[model samples]
Target: MKTSGNRVWLTYVLSDSDVPNALTLCFSLRRVLTSRRLAVIVSPKVSRVSREALSYGFDFVFTLDEERNTAGLENEDFVKLFALTLQGFEKCVMLSPNMLVVKNCDELLDKEEDVQQTFVFAENGDSSILRLRPSLQVFNCLLKQLAKRNGTGVDSILKKWLSDQTSQLTFIDDKYNQHLHEKASFLREEKNIAIVNLKNKTPHELDYVGEMVLQLWKSIYDKSVLPLLNAVANVRNQLL
Candidate 1:
């Protein structure tokens, strides 16, 4: 496999209900991502309109199928592992859809030069990246570690694995995966958040969560964030 000479940002959208926020996520990345490729793994449950919208923002949009071996994987979560299978990608970063990219995270792209370690994970959120050279081995390690933990979400498994520190993974700063709770006001004024993770929030909850995300975007991209907010509104309209 050849290198894409850059990293690829990977995310998943399992159903039509998740489309708008996922698109919002990719759109924000399009605004600030300087040199990384972007892709999304969609499932059969996604509607045509949502799929078409994804094409606009992602470089490659993979749809799940029997051949993809995604059967029985809750929310098509297993498909994230397939990102390691992509040819020509030197590195791949996986993020949950609810996470909003607030600034250029290209700095996170710098891997340890020796390449002995293959995974770099965020401290506070599910976002993680892997340098591809040893990705297959790393992916296998994760699958084995997580296999018996049925009913447990992939994020939790990886979070526990990385949090242990005894693991071979490199840890990225918590600022890259800032959360929007408990101290939302403080996080806003700090203004150093790179990716905003809205984990476990329902769609209706995202309405309020979005306000904080928009505020961050407003600070970084200025007025350009308005059109993106409008785009999200447009998608919400389609849902209704």
Candidate 2:
């Protein structure tokens, strides 16, 4: 579950046979990530190529059962397994395969030594942060009302963006965040992404799809939310 001194203090949750992404992750991060810090959780069906590829870079490997869930995709249990690693490793940083870090990703490793949260997520201006921004609340409310009227499909999009991954928002961060929320609090409202924003006068005023969903989830449920606030933030603080 934990590593003694792996370089990046990172882990990846994935099943076997996803060769293309695996290869991409290995090579993309290899130059920056050392052999000891990188690891992959694999299903038993991991191809020999995957195994060899992993062995070439990762310091740790976890083989898991392929038939362990509602779907082969990772879930809460998968998060827990990786969380266990965090419990032991302290500054552990976990990422999915599709997540690509183009900046100071190496800084996440120092989370423990400095006790600061570090991670960078692409800023999609249309994200749910608009709801919390205070300036956009009126506009967002107006947009939601229009959605209710025309059924054009832009309803509370982020709450349901990744329902499969975040069916509910957990209550763990309350103590740190002053106990302002509860478990199973936020569920993906599940809406259509093709909706347009008549609220915006300009065509370029809209945010992208991720801005609608995952960004919202991050606003509400990202206890470990990416902490890339400014371009100058010590990215090495978060882990590359």
Candidate 3:
């Protein structure tokens, strides 16, 4: 897969239960961003209906089995690494499924005159908006580096990567990666939250997304697309 001229956004689902959440993320991306090359890497555990729903929002859908090299990692969390193998993209942005885009991402990766790094990452998280120039060699190097480590989870691997590749990375605005540390404070500060992180998927988190989804729909699309997106979430919630 050689996607050297495309601007692609990548994400993945680990189980059938994550289908709806992933779809909501896709719909949110489609609603706010001008990019059309959104893709989702779904696992074999997801149902056909869930996959179909995924396809409705994304430009392309891939399965974990297709990404053989990414299999066998602890918790299947390494699945996000599949973005490196994505074909036909000049630039790739790997985003977590729970991140809500509060701003247009069309120029998210445009380098500033003062900047020198090759990557832009949303701060304070293992993974959020990761903008990178697609390179298989670099990804392979990271894989080998990760394999040599003793730690076995996404956060540990990510921290190691950041520490090792600090020269290549620049931080994006913290506002783009907001967290709900204090629920009341977050609610009071909704005006400042850009891309929210739904880490635990708590009820308030879902409710926050519910309200934001409506705002996104009203501002970009209509209410009709809500049911399908909601159905995807409902299905995943049932599995959870």
| Top candidate, metric TM-score | 3
For model 1, which pairs clash? 4-88
Residue by residue across 12-34, what tens digits does model 1's lDDT show? 88887676567667778877845
TM-score for all models, in order of appearance: 0.69, 0.38, 0.72
Q: Once superposed on the true structure, which residue ranges of model 2 sit more than 4 Å away at CA? A: 1-13, 33-36, 65-80, 83-88, 112-240
Ten-residue stretch with the least lDDT total in model 3: 109-118
Go through the candidates in order and give the C-alpha RMSD of each one to the true structure. Answer: 6.0, 18.2, 5.8
Q: Write one digit per residue (lDDT tens) for candidate 3, span 165-208.
A: 66555667666666544466466667666566655544444446
Residue-pair clashes per prediction, in order, are: 1, 14, 6
| Candidates 2 and 3 compared by TM-score, better number | 3
lDDT of 1: 0.63
lDDT of 1 at 153: 79
Clash pairs for candidate 3: 2-88, 3-87, 3-88, 3-89, 6-90, 20-232
In model 1, state the lDDT of residue 222: 41
All candidates' lDDT scores?
0.63, 0.34, 0.63
RMSD to native, candidate 3: 5.8
What C-alpha lDDT, on a 0 to 100 scale, does residue 121 get in candidate 3?
63
